[model samples]
Target chain A: MRYLLLVYAAAEEAAALDTRLALELAERGGLLAAHELEPVTTATSVRVRGAATLVADGPFAETCERLGGVYVVDLESLDEAIAVAARLPAARDGVVEIRPVVRREG
Target chain B: MSSVATVFREEFGRSVAVLARTLGDLDLAEDAVQDAFATAVERWPRDGAPANPGAWILATARNRAIDRIRRDRTLAGKRELLARLEREAPPAPADDDALPDERLALVFACCHPALAVDAQVALTLRLLGGLTTEEVARAFLVPEATMAQRLVRAKKKVRAAGIPIRVPPPEALPDRLRAVHATLYLVFNQGYGPPPRDELCDEAIRLTRLLAVLLPDEPETLGLAALTLLHDARRAARLDAHGDLVLLEDQDRSLWDEARIAEGRRLLDRALALCRPGPYQVQAAIASLHSDPEPDRRRIAALYDRLAELAPSPVVELNRAVAVALAEGPSTGLALLDALAEELDGYHLLHAARADLLRRLDRPGEAGEAYRRALALAPSEPERRFLAGRLHELPNGG
Candidate 1:
């Protein structure tokens, strides 16, 4: 199984992922990919209508917590994914959303 | 109990857990288990009960699930599962005793932290408790459709979020088990009043027993078993002949279930021997003390103090005040209650306790006011009547 951990943080707070935890996850072959996203100011939202494509600036929603980073990990279960997410430094000061990665082939 | 109902209670969780482990799908496993029970409910009486009910149900459920997969071969994402299930060995005989008791795994998955507490409870009841959606709704005092939706949503989350059906590792065991215990405790508490829902309490205690056995060394598990058993032992004595709520002080001690109390004490002793005193163990200790012919008030008060320290809740504080009043004096308890007046302003029991203490202290007027507040805030007719009866006994008809 695989999960995408979407890290969210306030605009002013720089959410830092723990390097040791990230290294351990990678070493254990659980961490597939990890990256910090550009701030919400650099986000571009797009919507497709029947014939028109509407483009907007900033993140998708005007919320205090903005999407800051993401970690894609292959794990045994959602609980394991959550355990990994909870070890992240940002989890203490922000929120981490876990979404299962759809498997095209088993 | 009817043989069918008895079989369902004993075998549902085991069958579903084994099925889910083999099938890798909680939703399918639950549906299959339900189908198996429905079949048993219809057939067992006419066909005569099977020798080994659990094995009978498991074999039947596995066969039906395979048949369903064969019938619905067009469904997407099931082809792989169907192939895998087909490659497995043929179904065993009904009397086969090799059925894996994986109910603890099922319980853990149902009580997963990702789900909301209510959802966890509903799922546990509907799946592990062998309860129908309507029965679960009635237990929770919600509409059937609401509970149905909740079950569907919870099952969907269990699938979509990939919450695996298995026991947690050692490090996560305590926290995960705590969640499981909370749901069971809630089920028992919900069964506290109504006779019709008393089965919920029985089911909760039954599951707690299973947990204690499956994880024999977890002192908290043992403590929870002790707590539920101890509380249940006093169920028969909680109300008077007039169907009125009986206060602990006024209840007939002879009515208590001595056997259950003895078993609870044994469990508590085991928990204490572990030297890992948690909230449930502390509360169970208090209940154990209360079960005594002449309860040691000071010891009970000391246990309450430990409980307050462990849990740190206003309700615990309130109980501690009562225990303190029992051990020390009403005036001391009254002083403690005064400190919590602001925090527990709306709690009826707080007012009731205050009223009791004031009445004992001979402050009839203050006691009258507190009794009136408690009466006004009382949630049920029995509680209101109990408070009113207390007031009626007061001087000047307070």
Candidate 2:
């Protein structure tokens, strides 16, 4: 099973670089991809309605926490994904949303 | 009444547990088991019970599951898995004896912390306890439809989220075990209280016994089993002939189940020997003290003190105050209870305990006011009646 861990945290909290944990996850033989996004200030939101493409200056939706990073990891079960999520540094200061990746056959 | 019915009652959880492991799908396993039971109900009476009824049920359920898998169009993608399952040799027929105990796995999955506590309780009762949705709803005082919805949503989450159906690794056992223990304790408490329902208590004890067997070395598991047994041993004496509440001091100790008390004591001793006293162990120790013919209130107070340290909750403090009153005096207990006034203002038992202390201290006016407050917050008819009786006995007829 592959899970996408969407890391969300406050801007200031996200600034704290903890690349060591990401390396640890990769060494654990599960991490497929990891990337820290630019700040929400640098994000541009785009929406496609039936006829128009509406562009906004900020992220999609304003919440207490902003999307800070993402990690796609292959794990045995959701429990394993949750274990990884709990270890994320952002999990202490914010939230890590774990969603099962939908696989489409070629 | 029939042997088939008896087998269904006893082997339902075990069969479902085994089938779920074999099929790798909880819902499919349950449906298959239900179908097998229905077949038994239809055939057993006419043909006489099979020599090994459980094996018959398991084989029948497996065949039905395979048939359904092959026929269902939506399961086309899963044809390979189904074919592989069918190709494997059937489990050896040993009646109910040879079935691997997959119930512990099912129980852990049902009580996963990711689910709401109520949902965990509801799922455990429905799946592991062999309770119908309506029965669970009735036990929890919820609408049947509400419970049905809750079960559907919880099952969906179990499938969609891929919650592993297995006991957690030993290192992660403590936290996961706590959730399982808490759910069982909640079930036990529900039946241990006013308007008591013995069935729920029995189910809880049964489930805890299963957990104890599965995790024999876990001290907390043993502690919980001991705690439930000790509390349940006194069930007969918990209420009077007229169905009113009986205080522990006034209850007929002769009515207590000595066998269960002895068993509970053994479990508690074993748990304490591990020297890893968690909340359940402390509570079992307290119950052990209370079970004594001449309960050592001082030791009970000390146990409560330990319990408060382990699990710092207002309820523990309330219990500790009662123990202090028993060991020391009403004044000392009253002081402790007063300190908790702000935190436990909404809790009816706090006022009731305070009222008892005041009544003992000869403060009729204060006791009357406290009793009234307790009555106002009291949720159950028996408790309200008990408070009213106490209030009426006050000096000024309050």
Using lDDT as the measure, the top candidate is: 1
Write the residue-wise lDDT of candidate 1 on B170-227 in tens digits: 9998899899999999888888863426788898999999889988899999999999
Query: What TM-score does each of the candidates earn?
Result: 0.93, 0.93
List, residue by residue over B1-398, the lDDT tens digit for candidate 2.
34876887657787777777666577877888889989998898898887777778878888888888777766534766586667755667854566566898888888998889999999899888778899999999999999999998988777767788887898788889999999999999998879898989999999998888888888999999999999999999988887889898998999999999999999989888988889999999888888998999999999999999999999899999989998999999999999999999999999999999999999999999999999999999989988999999998987
Clashing pairs in 2: none
Model 2 CA deviation exceeding 4 Å by range: A11-18, A24-29, A43-55, A103-106
Question: Which 10 consecutive residues of model 2 chain B have the lowest summed lDDT?
Answer: B75-84
Q: What is the lDDT of residue B371 in candidate 2?
A: 99
* DockQ, cand. 2: 0.44
